[model samples]
Target: MMISAATPFTLLGQNLLLLPQKAIFWEQQKALIIADVHFGKVGHFRKAGIAVPRDMEQSDLATLSDLISEYRPEKLLFLGDLFHSDMNNDWDWFILWRSQFPSLQIILIRGNHDIIADSHYQKLNIELYDELLIGPFLMLHHPLPDIQLQHASGYVFCGHIHPGVSLSGRGRQSITLPCFAFSSKQAVLPSFGKFTGKVAIRSRLTDKIFAVLKDKVIAID
Candidate 1:
């Protein structure tokens, strides 16, 4: 499957490709940065007697595969929430997927929903970290506090709230779309999972917001 053309944006002098798949490819680092995948979410709900389409899980994996094929990144950096819940049948699916890419370096910054045992991730060769500082960006699951941002060493790339933007039309119609929210000191990525909620964000006058549409990423004017 082919993804829509990725939109390029510069932050802290680093060139990043914002894909319609709700992920970022850092050009210099050759890393695919994504967040809030919630891999086992569908299964978690289904197990609880909530009827969710089982194909939804496979679709997410397919999109990831497409991104990997398209970019061939050296590493995949998951800001947080790689899995929705603890070990479940959905985990088996993830295991099968991981086996297909044994050479890919996957890293996850532990998120609130990431309650799975460390040993499980270790067995899959996935690196775990609370926060990672690489080059000019600090990779984290949750955005830093206002006071911490004041003294932060580099621009932070985080994804906890599943940030989005509300767009208005001429007839006072408005819709919220997942977005890449960029301020001077931080950037929030959209959730990379199909079954996730997005919180519409209030942007500043100087902030740059790129809304992800069905097949493209568009800059919000």
Candidate 2:
């Protein structure tokens, strides 16, 4: 296992640590970056009379808690899709989780799946934004095209598509793994929620791709 659970990469003169947990850490900002968490997804499925594991949300929350304890980030920046859909019993878990980290500022960039009323987030002391320009990065729910991104005021960090890259072996085996894709103008983060699906991405020669493994992240050469 890759015990460190971190891979360092520098962007726009600032340092970023890509983590196996499908999150990122902005060293200068002292913030934990997560995208597409879909917190209540399992509950949504179960609500439809489908059998889904009840521990999924708890597991994801536990992982987030662990990261918080280890990094001690002052703020939590969520790119988008923080919750799956609607207000469900699973929301109570989030409320309890929020209570534990009363001092840690949580910020969410509004996304399509975030249909919950603003009052709900406000009640938890969470800040909501359509888009945000923080330091050298512009945070958004949907990633912009390269043309638009080039003219953006800052390097972009966004997530909407759950990105993945296909890997092939000498034995004709192929597998798709979630990845962190970095282009000259933007960085598309992988979905942090394990219950989400991944879409394979075709990257350019100059782009950097970091494939996430079970316990570590590896850069694709």
* C-alpha root-mean-square deviation, candidate 2: 1.5
The C-alpha lDDT values of all candidates are 0.93, 0.94
Candidate 2: stretches off by over 4 Å: 1-3
Worst 10 residues of 1 by lDDT: 3-12
Candidate 1 on 143-217: residue-level lDDT in tens? 987789999878899999999899889999999999999988999999999999999988999889999998889
**What's the lDDT for residue 13 in model 2?**
89
RMSD to the true structure for each prediction, in A, is: 0.9, 1.5
Give all TM-scores, in the order shown.
0.98, 0.97
Model 1 alpha-carbon drift over 4 Å, by segment? none
How far off is residue 216 in model 2, in Å?
0.8
Clashes of 1: 0
